[model samples]
Structures are given as C-alpha cells and as structure tokens.
Target: MFQSTKQTAQTANLTAGGHALPADWLGRIVLIWSGYAVSMFAGNAASYAGIWYATETTGSPLSLALLYVLAFLPMGLLSPFGGVVADKLNRKVIIVVCDALMALTSLALAAWTFIAGPSFAAVALYCAAFGFVSGFRTPAYNATMPLLVPECHLVRINSMDTLLGSISMIAGPALGILLYTSFGLQYVLILGGFGAAAAGVTMLLAVIPRDHGAHEQAGAWASLKEGASTLASQRGLLVLTIGVSLGMLAYGPIDSLMPLMVYDHFGGDGFAASLVAAVMGAGLLVGSVILMAVNPRRKLARIIVVSAFVVGTGALIAGLIPKGGYWAFVVCIGVLAIACAWFNAPLMTLLQKNIPDEKLGRVMGLFTAMNGLAIPAGTALGGLIAEVTGTPLFFQIDGVFILLLAVSIAISKSVRKLDAASSDHPTVEQTL
Candidate 1:
C-alpha cells in the first residue's frame, strides 16, 4: 500500500509553510513548552492520592479501579467525535477550552474530597470528566506541535516534551503518595485542583498558531470518513498505525501484570511497588533522549519492529525468571522503555508528514482513540489472562503475541520499506 521509492520522490515536501527556527521563534517555543511541563505536573498531581483516597476510605480495589476504568473508557469512546471537533474548531481554542473544563473538574473533585469521604461514584465521575476533556485535547496537542516550533526542530521539541512529561509522571505519583501518607488525601487533591487551574489559565496566555477549521471542515461522520480515507490510500502509513496499535495491545499485559507479579511473586510493596512505575518512566525518558540522535525515519521499520520485539521478550523473561530481584525487574523494565521511546515520535511525525494539515486533527483523533481503546482492553484482558493462567504465565503468553506483530510487520513490504520509500519515492511537493 505504501508508495514505492520512485513514487515518494515525487511527493516529498521538504519545504512546507515555514522555514527552520530563528531565535525569536525558539524563545516562544521554550516559553510555551515550559508552561506545559509545569501544568502537567500540577494537573496530574492528585492521581495517586485519588487512588489512595478510594482505597483507604472504602478498602476496595474495585473502588480505586473505578477511577482508571472511567478515565480510559470515555477517552476511547468519544475521541473520534472529539477529533471532528478539533478539526472543525481552532486547535488552540479547543485546547484552552478543554484545559479549562478539566480545571473545573479538578477543583470540584478537591472540594468534594475535603467536605466528605470519596464515594466511588463521585471519584469515577471526576475521572471520567477529565478523561473526556483530555481525549479531545490530545489530537489538538499533537497537531499543534509542528506549528509551535519549526520543522527542523520538531524532533528536538517532541523529545523535550516527552522527557519532561515523563519526569512529571514519576514525581507526581510520588508526591501524591507522600502527601496522602503524611497530611492526608484531601490536601493533595486540593493541590491537584490548583495545578489544573493554573495549567488552564497559563494556556490562555500562550500564543499558539491557528491551524484548525481552516477548511470548511467535515461533519463528525465525515471527519472519520476522511481519516479512514486518508489512511486507506496511504499504504505505508496505514500499516504503521496498525503496527503501533498492536504493539500497544501486547505491551499492556506487561504493564498491568508486572506490578502484581512483583508484589506477589516477590515481596516488594509500598515504595517498591511505586518504584516499578518510576523506573519504567525514567527509562522511557532516557530512551527518548537516545532516539533523538537516531531518527526513526532513517530506519523506521527496524526500530518499530525490533523495539516491539524487545518489549515482548523482556516482559516474558522478567515474568519467567524464578528468583530475580529489584535489579532484574528494573533492567527488564528498562528494556521496555527502550522500545516505547523508539516507537512514539516518528510514528506521529510520519503521519504529520504524509497527511494534509487541515486533516491532522481528524487523523490524529483516530490515532488517539485507537490508543485509548487499546489500553483498557489490553489491561482488562491482561487481568483476565492472569486469572486464568496466572500472572507469570500470562506475561509469557502476551510476550508471544507481541512477537507475532513484529513478525507480521517484518514480512509486510509496506511497513518494511516505509521510511526509505516515504522519503525517496514520493514527490510530496517537497518544495512548497
């Protein structure tokens, strides 16, 4: 389905609307990026606390799990329409509006936590509301990045964003844990409210380029229709998306099962339980930095395919090893970190390069939705698998599934030649 080398040569568009960054544009980018990093820390600070609140108050894993299910479910279910909205509206406007709504939800959740105990239903409602807004925001955020910075600096900017965000993910959970253990869950949630509100307000101040609703825009159904049409036509791009989606599905079992396995198979908890997540995130940041130097487009198939294989193998080995300790666990997780970093940036960049700017949100909406949908099902399936075959056996079985994806892609000509063909084969009107 992908364009051959000869065809891509005709389609390549090296010179789009903007040139490489000048000094002023670089400064503006830094200003916006820094704001986003700070807001992310605050907006997500209460995640661990929310879980702790549900567990401590109700003594129920189901109560805590409710928050997660609510978060992922709406994001996946509503994302297609959300993408349509993004394409139909100004992206900056959509982001600002969504951030504001999230802030309100955060604030309300904090208020409720302070006044009374966390009812499972109340927490689920808050999580779901935030998830809905976030689901909408992701495509807009992805679509906006290339506009905020120059094409030449796209990789650097994306790497920096992922790096900083990964750090925030680690710190936020730890902070929530500490806040809940010492002062209590209510205070931590209040802090989360403030963070979300601040993130929303600062977003209003940042001047982002407008690229949404540029065309008359398609209706909701038409938006998805357009997205599918685009992918259907681009052979390389379609295979790439499917490969990544499958990778996510297979990796989910490891992510869901590993912690449980560590706690039960080995005797690690509290700080140790948290460390597993932190280590993986830390590895992701490190891997992202490494890949910044090694562009995926240069060897797109090898990286995506091999990295996925590594994740699958590492997960199985980690689960199967009889007496491995913290060090082994950390190392195996680091392997996954490598795979994840290798996968993210280029996949989206490839889409951005191939798809028209007017349709980015719509296309990314499908992307966002697929990712959202995959996570919940993967997680649920992992839990179910563990129940049947046991966690250790499930990880090993899932590892085999991940391996199958790599095998599938390696044999497919479209994916194997994607990078080389995309760069050389199409004209892409590169000199626009």
Candidate 2:
C-alpha cells in the first residue's frame, strides 16, 4: 500500500547514495517511521515528566514559562545553520548523529536527576540541549521524505506522519503520568534515552537518497543566502510562509491561555480544561485520519486557505461563548484543532513537491525557525493582550486578525497559482 506506481521518469531517476531505488524502500521508510514513533512518544513523556517536576519543585509560573521558552529558543536560533548542514552533508548522517547526541543527553539527564533529585536548573538545561539537537534533526528528516517516497504519495505519507504525532500527543501524557508516579523522573528520562537511541539505529538501517554535489562547493554563509533567496524568489511560497507564520502567531496564544480561559471565563476547573484539551487532541486525530483517507492530490492551497478560515471562525466563536457555554467552547476548540491539523500536511507536501531537493533542507530549516519563533512571540504578546483586554477579548482580536489574513491569502493571485505550479513537476536544478 505504501508503494506508488505513478513515479514520473524524472522522479524515478532520483538516487539514494548513488545507487538505484531499492525494492524494499517501503520497508525501509516504515523502519524510519517506527524509530521516529518511539522517539516521539518518549520525548513527549519526558517533557510531561519534566514539566510536572518543575511545577512540583518550584511552583513558579515564571519558571514554567522560562522552561517552555528554553525548549524552543535554541531551535529557533540554530535552525538556519542546521538547514545549511542538512543541504551540505549526508542527511542520514545528520539524523543519526543528532539522535545519538540526544540519546546521550537524555541518559546524562537521567543520571543527573537520579543524583541531584530533579532541580529546575537541570531540567532547563536538558530542554535546551534537546532543542539544540532537534534544530539539526528536523530539517534533515523533512528534506529526506521526498527522497524516500514517491511524489504521488507525499500527501499520504505526510498525513501518516501527522497521525503518528497526534497519537503520541494523546498517549504520551498518560505514559508520563504513569511512569512518573510509579517509577519517577529518572525512569522517564531513561526511556527517552532509549527512544533516541532507537531512532538513531533505525536511521542507520535505512538507505536515504541524497544529491552528492548539491551545495558541495558553497560555504555556509553562501548556502544560507541561497536558501533565503530561494524562498524570496517564489512569491507564492513567500506569501504562504508569511501567512502560516502569522496564523501560528494568532493561534499560539490559545495554548498558553486555554486553561485560564476555562477558569476565568467559562467558570470551569482543571478537569474541564483537561477535557477540552483531550477533545482537541481527538479532533486532531480525526483530521489526520480524514486526510489520510482522502489523500488529496490537488488544490492543496485551497485546502490551506479554507482551513485557516475555519480555524479563525472557530476561535471567534469560542471567544464569544458565555460563562455557561463551556460545552460550546469545547466544541469550538475541537473544530479549531481539526482545522489546525489540516495545516501541516498540505503545506509540507507543497514545499516538498516544489522546492528542489538540494535546497529543501535550508528552506525547511528557515521555515521551522520562523514557526518556532512565532509561537513564543505570540504567546508573550497574547499574555500582554489578555492581561489588558481579558482572555476572551484577546481571542476575539486574534480571530479577527487571522480571518483577515486568510482572506488576503485567498485573494492573492500568486498563492492561487501554486496549484498549477506544483503540477509541473520541475527538476531539482530548477530554482524556486
């Protein structure tokens, strides 16, 4: 089922490590996915455990915010350089090395926790280290997808990736609570270490295709500039990227403020907040399943545009909910989550389909960095706005901003042209 018979001649010519495509490529790709699945679960569990530990140890809101920022800041700062490396080096080697380093870091964190009893400083340090390695790992893994799977299957594969991620999100917290309550943070960290090691080993077992001469002559600065130029050269992609980043900015506050919204506005407690979160997660899972079943191959830009509109409307409605309308708010949150789930797969597929493989890493890296930076910035801004106008009012404003952004994207001729452009199947040498 993973195999695609519709590979164009141009796509079929793509090679892995100077060798022809192997018959067992599907099996190899599945192995890579399996490794990632293990890591995702472990990483999520470790994050939950660490956050709980922090809450118990310091019980400071500022400390929790700092911990969250530390997790994303390094990745935001380092992703561009990591992308340069992904384009220049063997991507498989990058993945393997980063995963191995993460494994070692997790092991070290476990040992430290066992001895030091889970201080705030140690957890913060561990978060920074994990984010640092992930900055490198993410781009390589994203760029490697097209090399392993046929172009026709990109949407399905991307959907599957999101599906697994959603599963990890839903289940990881449960595992973290169980492990933390029963065994402690040390065991959770140990599990994380093993997960990372498993991911590294799977990458080692897989055969990943790479362009041997792509960006080989360019220095890091030159390559970085090229990635930027490549992004700017395509007006549609540039607009799309900006729009997505803005969407993240609008939506990011919801994550930070959801519990508060429940408490302050809806007059609900922690259980209600947790229920809302669980329902939203289920919405994401449902969206992934639908996308996988549909395997949309056309009008991806339209899908994105519509999804943004749905999310904006959902948020606006959510903000308008009265104190007694907790169920209504929960339903809106689910709808928003479903729309948000639709965003990634189509967008990533568009990038993979259009961006030349040689330059995909740097472009993906920059994309990741922008997105990573946007959420925290949005959260900070949202907090300020919420403090002033209140949580519901802030959501109302965020929703309006996003709705306008969606309309602007829909009206843009450049973005509308992306559908036709993606169908052309340009060769890797083509820029933009």
Q: Quote each prediction's TM-score.
A: 0.87, 0.87
Query: Per-residue alpha-carbon lDDT of model 2 for 1-432, expressed as tens digits?
Result: 112333445455543222356677789889999999999888877876676666556544345556656776677778888888998889999999999999999899899989988677777877888879978998888888877777656788888777777777677766776798788888988988998999999999987766543636788889889999999998988888888988987877776577667766887744565566567777888899998888887788888899999999998888898889999998898888888788888988888876787888899999888877777677767777777788888888988988999999999999989877765644333322
lDDT of 1 by residue, 271-383 (tens): 56557667777887887888777543455566778877888788777777664576787778877776777777777777776777677777888887887777766776666
Q: What is the lDDT of residue 321 in candidate 2?
A: 88
The regions of model 2 sitting more than 4 angstroms off are 1-20, 52-64, 181-183, 213-215, 259-275, 322-327, 422-432
Best by lDDT: 2
Model 1, total clashes: 24
Query: How many Å off is the CA of 270 in candidate 2?
Result: 6.4
Local distance difference test values of all predictions, in order: 0.68, 0.79
- What's the true lDDT of residue 179 in model 1? 81
Pairs clashing in candidate 2? none
lDDT of 1 at 44: 52
Could you tell me how far off, in angstroms, the CA of residue 399 lies in candidate 2 after the best superposition? Answer: 2.2
